[model samples]
Target: MAIDKEKIKQAIRLFLEGIGEDPDREGLKETPDRIARMWEEFDRQREFNFKLFEEFGDYNEMVIVKDIRFYSLCEHHLLPFFGKVHIAYIPDKVVCGLSKLVRTVKAFSLRPQVQERLTQQIADFLQEQLNPKGVAVVIEAEHLCMSMRGVMTPGHITVTSALRGIFLKDLRTREEFLKLIGKQGL
Candidate 1:
């Protein structure tokens, strides 16, 4: 469904009032419009089409894209969580562009999300589209809800991973993927 910018603007105004801020103040008057526009830009995931880039390829080895930076809002608290994602897949007969892997990560991260679900969605999308022999995704993030609020452990990072097909069934394949991504203690 499409997001209603006007509704967002109205909501922001209401939020400011609820927080005891005057929405009509000179400095705050344009805040609602700015927030609405920001949401529109961040929500570009809705427009991304992953299937448009699938193509035949002779390569059959593991394709790994690591250290993809992503920023997302925590669904529970609406706080920011920023981190890196590492994705790997062993193709069967086709592959996608390297940039598409980054785009996939961006598409998923553009919304309010949990790192675990975001990891799984990326793996699932590659598994379904490329029908790869295996797919793996690892994400490490520092959530502001956790660090800036709750526990307040500023440097703490949460790591999550999703493995499918061979990566789930084969220990060695999973190990290799982890190793290639410079991850240890799997």
Candidate 2:
């Protein structure tokens, strides 16, 4: 679905007025337009393609891509949350390009999201596209809504994980994934 940029601009203007900021002020006049443009860029994930997955016949092992940095807006508060995602999958007959994992994370993270759902979406997408024997996704993030407001506890991080197939059933497979990703504490 296409975003209504004009509606967003209007809402931002109203929000500025509600917050007692002069939307017509010299410095703030274009703020709404700028925010709308920023949203356009942030929402580009809506256009992402998953056809990048490629089939491979010989290699079948755990493919680990770790420490992929991402930025997202919290759906609850519209505040920023930034994080690193670790992805691991045991291939069956197909393996995706390494960069495709990063792109998948980017596509999901670009939307307003919670870290937990974002982690699952990446794992689920990989599972569906690559038909991997198993998939594991871990996300560690700091939400501005938490640190900048609510508890006001800075440096607090939230970690979430999603495990599928063998990662959920095999203790050793899961352990190896966690240890390799440096998330053994999970």
At residue 64, give the lDDT of candidate 1. 98
The digit string of per-residue lDDT tens for model 2 on 104-179 reads 9988898789888898888898889888889999999999999999998889889999999999999999999999
Worst 10 residues of 2 by lDDT: 46-55
lDDT of 1 by residue, 8-34 (tens): 999999999999999999999999999
lDDT (Cα, 0-100) at 108 in candidate 1: 82
TM-score of candidate 1 on Cα atoms, chains taken together: 0.94
Name every residue pair that clashes in candidate 2: none
lDDT of each: 0.89, 0.89
